[model samples]
Target chain A: MRIGELAERAGTTTRTLRYYESRGLLPARRAENGYRTYDEGDLRLIQQIRTLQDFGFDLEETRPFVDCLRAGHPAGDSCPASLAVYRRKLGELDALIGQLQSVRTEVGAQLARAELEASAELPGGPEPRCELGPTAPQSPVGPNWEDER
Target chain B: MRIGELAERAGTTTRTLRYYESRGLLPARRAENGYRTYDEGDLRLIQQIRTLQDFGFDLEETRPFVDCLRAGHPAGDSCPASLAVYRRKLGELDALIGQLQSVRTEVGAQLARAELEASAELPGGPEPRCELGPTAPQSPVGPNWEDER
Candidate 1:
């Protein structure tokens, strides 16, 4: 199929398809007229790429797996290098999850603080509080030290 | 203190401080020689800006909150609009976390599958399990079900 057709079928833009091609994830044959021709394998590879990207693997990191697949290696028995790549990706994902969890905790605490301050009447009057503005003191230096070792 | 001093104390580059000034996040007074002068409050504001950025808030989104603080309004109070912004940001973070979690699960599954296949050592020589090459099997219809879905 043509580049446009492949892009339409793949649910991505032609630009993205070209980018994947440039990244060595997708290979296409150039026609006499210079049009790029892609086949079913290209489609499957694109699907795998999209699925992995949805699952958070950056394009650069997904290349080895794509290459292994293209080389006719079985899914689970592909290149040992691919296995190493997967391990590295797993580690990165773990780190990302830890960071996100920390951020979630901080945001939750901030939300609770906002709600608490919102419930109290401001000193001036019944006007809605502007706790997010300048006058509010910085969050207490640290959470209560009771849990500290 | 001057911009250089503030930048040094804040652990940021002078270029970044200048960028913040250009972006209206930091306000500074111009001296006779065109040098920028910063006060203690400005330092505090810079610190707060850094903190907010660390918390994943973009400079544009932090602008109103910074402005309220600069104007001496109560900082912690919930401005409905700012709260709305916070909610939007939280939603984005949640979506990101969900995506990362999904990716983690998929990667884990792939790793398990790879390990299992590696251990099995099937009697038959390896054949390409999935059509990942250009000439691989073509779907009768358009793209694969995963892509269409």
Candidate 2:
């Protein structure tokens, strides 16, 4: 198949396929007219790359899996190199999640503190409403505390 | 105060202050000697911008808080516009955390599946190690599934 046909089959773009080729993840043979040609094996490698890409692997990170597939492995992760990449990515994702969770906690605290200060300045009837418990003043507007963008 | 003093007081760099000025976030006044001049209020605004930056806010997203502080509010989130930015950021953070969590879940599942597949390929004597149970078949040599590469 041609580049366009393979890209169509992979549900990716020709540009992405070209990028993968540039990175040597997917090498192709040339037709007589200088067009990129692919076979079922090539398609298999591209599919392996695409599956890893969908799992958030960078192009460089997918190289090991591509190499494994090119080495005739039954699956991409059938090799140790690919498994190492998966392990590295898992650690990075875990650290990223921890950082984001910490940021969420801090940002939530700041939002609560700012809201409390804002409400305290209002013309409440001085019921000792500051630095104390809240009776849930002013029905919430805009996005709620648990809302997502 | 001079640019150096301002940067030092804010625990940042003159390059960063200049970048912020170029982005029109923290414009500085020109001294008679052709140097940049700053005041305490400018310092306050820079601090506000820094706080938001620390909270993972983009420079553009910190504009509302800067504007609020410039409008003489007690704090950055003291204004409705700043509060709206907070709400928007909260929504964005929530969405981002949600996406990362989903990715984490999928990556974790992939890791587990790949580990199981890798372990199953060992030279065990085929003692019902098909897909059901694993009674410590082979001694681990390469990266364990529990190991973070």
The second chain of candidate 2 has a TM-score of: 0.79
Can you write out model 2's per-residue Cα lDDT over B1-149, one digit (the tens) per residue? 99999999999999898888777577667989999999999999999888888889999888777766765677877766666667777888888888878887887887789888767766563542222122322235622223222
CA shift at A71, candidate 1, in angstroms? 1.1
Tell me how many residue pairs clash in candidate 1. Answer: 14
Candidate number achieving the greatest lDDT relative to the actual structure: 2
Q: What is the per-residue lDDT of model 2 for residues A30-116, given as tens digits with 9 covering 90 to 100?
A: 999999999888888888787777767878888777767776777777767777787788888888878877887887887888888
Best by DockQ: 1
What fraction of the native interface does candidate 1 get right in terms of contacts?
0.37
Q: Please provide, for model 1 over A1-149, each residue's C-alpha lDDT reduced to its tens digit, 9 standing for 90 to 100.
A: 99999999999999999878765568779999999999988888888788777766688767667777777764422656566767888899889888877887887777668667766655556765454543344446623322212
Candidate 1 residue B15 Cα shift, in angstroms, is 0.8
> What are the DockQ scores of the candidates, in order?
0.21, 0.20
State how far residue B84 of model 2 sits from its true place (Å). 1.5
The weakest ten consecutive residues by lDDT in model 1 chain A span A140-149
Model 1 ranges off by over 4 Å: A121-149, B74-82, B122-149
Query: A-chain TM-score in candidate 2?
Result: 0.79
